[model samples]
Target: MSGPRMTVVFATRDRATLLPRVLDRFAELQSPPGGWSLVVVDNGSRDRTVEVLRSYTDRLPLTALSCPQPGKNRALNAALQHLQGDLAVFTDDDVLPEPDWLVRLRAAADSHPEADLFGGTVLPDWPQPKPDWLCERAVEFSVLYAQQRRPSGACGFADIFGPNMAVRSAIFAAGTRFAEHVGPDDTNPLYAMGSETELLRRLEGAGHRGWFEASACVRHIIRPEQMEERWILNRAFRYGVGEGRHYAGRRSVGLLVRRLVYGIAARGSALLPPSPRRLRIRYRDRWLAGVAAGRPAARASPPSG
Candidate 1:
C-alpha cells in the first residue's frame, strides 16, 4: 500500500496460449512508477499451462499457484492469499487489455481512495467482420449497464465481468473474502450466492466506494463456444440465479412481479416479427431457461488441460 500502487492478478483454468499476450500487454504499460505484479491462478489445469507459464521466466515478477479445484473463486482465493498489492487487478485469461490498463485502474483507485470497489467497461472483441450474432450479444451485454451514470443497483441490473474488473487490496486484506461456497463454483456465486456485483454491494454496505471509468477497457473473447444458442440461454438463466441469490433477503411481491414482467417482456421480444431468425431461437431458449429458473449448479467443470 505504501510503495507500489497496484498488482495484476490473472486467474485461468487452461489458457497457456493466451497468457503471454495478456502479459505482454501489461508489460507495455507506459511510464508506470509503481511496482506491479501478475499472479497466475491455475484453477486445475492439466495442459502444458504450467510449462508455458515457465516460459515467462524472464517476466520475473510472475507467480503461479495451482488450485486443483475447478471453481473460479476457489482458484482466485488461493491466488489472492499470495498477493500483496495495494490494488488487485483481475482480468480473465481470455481477455486482452490495452497497455494503459494498469495506469487507468491505478488512477481510478487513487482518485477515489474511499471506494473499496472499482469497475470498468468490458467491450466485446468481435471478429474483424463482426457477425450479426456478435452484434446482438454486444447489445445484450451493454444494455445491462449503459444507463449507469454511476455505481448503483437501481438500474434493475447490476453486474461486472470477472475478466475486466479490479478491487482494492484491502477488500481482500481487510478480510472481505469472496464466498468460497458459490460463484465461479459449479455455476454458483462465490460468496454464498453473490457474484462480483454482490461483493461490491457488500463493499458499499461496509462504506467502501465503487466507481466506473471509460479508460479501463478490455476486449472480452467471445469464443465460438460461447456463441452457441444453448450457451447464451444458459448464461441468461445463470444471470437470473445469481441476481436472485444476491437479493435473497429482500425479495418481495413487487420484485417477483417485476421478474415475471421481465420474463414476459423477453418472450415478447423474442416474438418480435423483425428479430433475427437465428437470434430469436436463442431468445426463446433464454426465455425458457428463465422460466425454468435455470438448472441447478453444474457439478461438471469446464474441460481442462
Candidate 2:
C-alpha cells in the first residue's frame, strides 16, 4: 500500500525573523512515499513575513496563502480549502520538526488506519543560559508552551496538543474547522487560548480516535521574552480562560469561594522564597481568575475568503 499523502498546515503573523529557520527545518523533512506539501497562511502580517515566505518557494513544496485576518484559527480555516492529501498535519510556525517527523506521522497513519487524529512529542528548544525558574518548572509549564511527551498508543483529544498534531483530511473536507472565536488574535490580548483543543475535542466527540506517535517529535522554540515572570503568569491566566470555556457549565458558588481563597493565598506567597509550590499556586490562582471571567465577549467577525 502507498504511504498517505499529507498536507502540512500552519498559520503565522509578524514572525518574519523566525520563519526562515522554521522553513529551513521544513525543507529538511524526509518526504513520505505519497509525498507532502505545505500550506502556510500569513494572518495579516505587517512585517517582512511575506517576503520571507516568497524566498522559500524554490526550496520546499510550499503554497503560501494570506488571510489578512488577525486570528490564528481564521487563517487556518481559510487554508482548509487548499489542503492536498489524505492527512492534514497542523503545527505552529515556531515549531521545528525532526527530520523524520512527516515520515513518522505517515507511518503512524498507515499503521493505525482506525485512528483519525495523531499527536507527537513536543520538547522545548530553550534559549542558552536557561533561567533557573524555567528549569525548575519546565514540565509543570509545558502546556503554556504547547509542549508534551506522551507514550505512543491510544490517546484522547486532550493529549493531542497543538504545535504537533495531525488529523485525517476527510474531517476537514467534511467542514470541521478551528473555532474562530477562540484562539490567538493579534488584535485581542484577552482571546481564549485553546484554538486547536476545541477542534480536537469536537472531533473526538464525533467518535474519531486519536493516536500518540512518540518517535515523531518537534521542538517548540522558547522565545526570550517568554522567560519573564509577567509573561508566564499571563499565560497561566489565558490557559485558565480556555479551560473555563471548555467547562463553562461547571462553575458554582463553592468554586467561586475557592478561587477567592486561592487568589489571596497566592498573593501572600509572593513574599516567600520563589519555590515551585509558590509559582504553582500563583498559576492556579490566575487560572481561577480567568475561569471566573469565562470567555471574552464576541469580537469582530473574521474576514471572508
Candidate 3:
C-alpha cells in the first residue's frame, strides 16, 4: 500500500458460474506497491454475472461497471474512465494469478520506470490432460493463452497477450484505446481476437518501451469444450481471420495467389504425415487454408482509412 497504485481490469460476459472463483483468486493476490483495486466491466451479460459480482462487493476492493455494448474492447474502454490508479493491468475473467503476480509486476515497473507496457507469463491450467495431437509445447500454446516461457526479459509489443498485460495510466491518458472492431464480442460471430495485439503494436510503433516480467504468472483455465478437436480447429480458423485482417493494408492479388498456392501445397503435404504429426500438420494446414480463404476478399477491398 506504499508504492505505485494499480488497477486491475477485466471484462466478462455470461460466465457467472466461473467468475466467483476468479474473484476468489483475486482476493488472494498481494497488493502492488501503491495499493491496488479491481475494476470489472460487465459486457451486457444476460446471466447472473452482475449478481455474482455484487456478491464480492465487500470482500474485495472492487468496482463493477455496466457496459451495455457487446465487445470486450468496448467494456475495457468503458472501464478505463473509472480506473483510479497510475497503472492499469489487464487480464481476462478466467485467469488465476499467482499470489505474487502483482508484486512481481510492481517490482518490474519500479525497476524499469522507462517502460510503458508490461507483459507477464501465462500458463495453461487444463481441466483434463491434453490429447496426444496437441503436444506440450510452451512456445506454440498461445492458442490456450500460454505465452512463451523465458527468463524475465524484453519482448516485442505484439508478443503481449491480453490475459496478462499491463500499461501505465499515462498511455491511456494519451488517448490509446483498444481497437473496437477486431476483438472478442459475445454477440459478434467473427471473433477476430486481436484488440490487445493491435493496441500494443500501435504503442510500440510510436516508440513506447515494454518489458516482460517472468514472475508475474497467471494460469489460464482451459475448459473441457476447448479441449475438443473441433473447437481447436475453429480457434485456428479465427487466428487465420486475424492474420487476414492484419494484412488488409498491404494485401495484393499476387500475394493472394501465392497464399492460395502455398495453402494447397500445405494441404497436399498434410495428407502424407504419419499419425503422430498428422493431426498437428492438419491443424496448421487448416489454419493456412483459412488464411487463404479470408485473403482474397480482404485484398479486393481497400483498407479503411
Return the top candidate by lDDT. Answer: 2
Residue-wise C-alpha lDDT for candidate 2, range 148-188, written one tens digit per residue = 88799999998988899999999989889889978999777
- Residue 22, candidate 3: alpha-carbon lDDT: 89
TM-score of each: 0.76, 0.93, 0.88
Residue 286, candidate 1: alpha-carbon lDDT = 44
Candidate No. with top TM-score: 2
lDDT for 97 (candidate 3): 93
Off by over 4 Å in 2: 135-139, 295-305
User: What is the Cα root-mean-square deviation between model 3 and the actual structure?
Assistant: 4.3
Rank by TM-score, highest first: 2, 3, 1
Backbone clashes, each candidate:
11, 0, 3
Estimate, for each residue in 195-242, the C-alpha lDDT of model 3 and write its tens digit.
888899889999999999888999898889987655665666667667
lDDT of 1 by residue, 1-305 (tens): 34455777766767776667666765666534576777888787767788877777575477877888767777777887877668788777767677777777777777776565676667766445544654454336543222222342211114445666788787687677766655566444221233555566666677665666667777776666665555555555555455545544553455456556655665556545433554544444443334334334423222101
After superposition, the stretches of candidate 3 with alpha carbons farther than 4 Å from their true spots are 136-139, 251-276, 293-296, 299-305
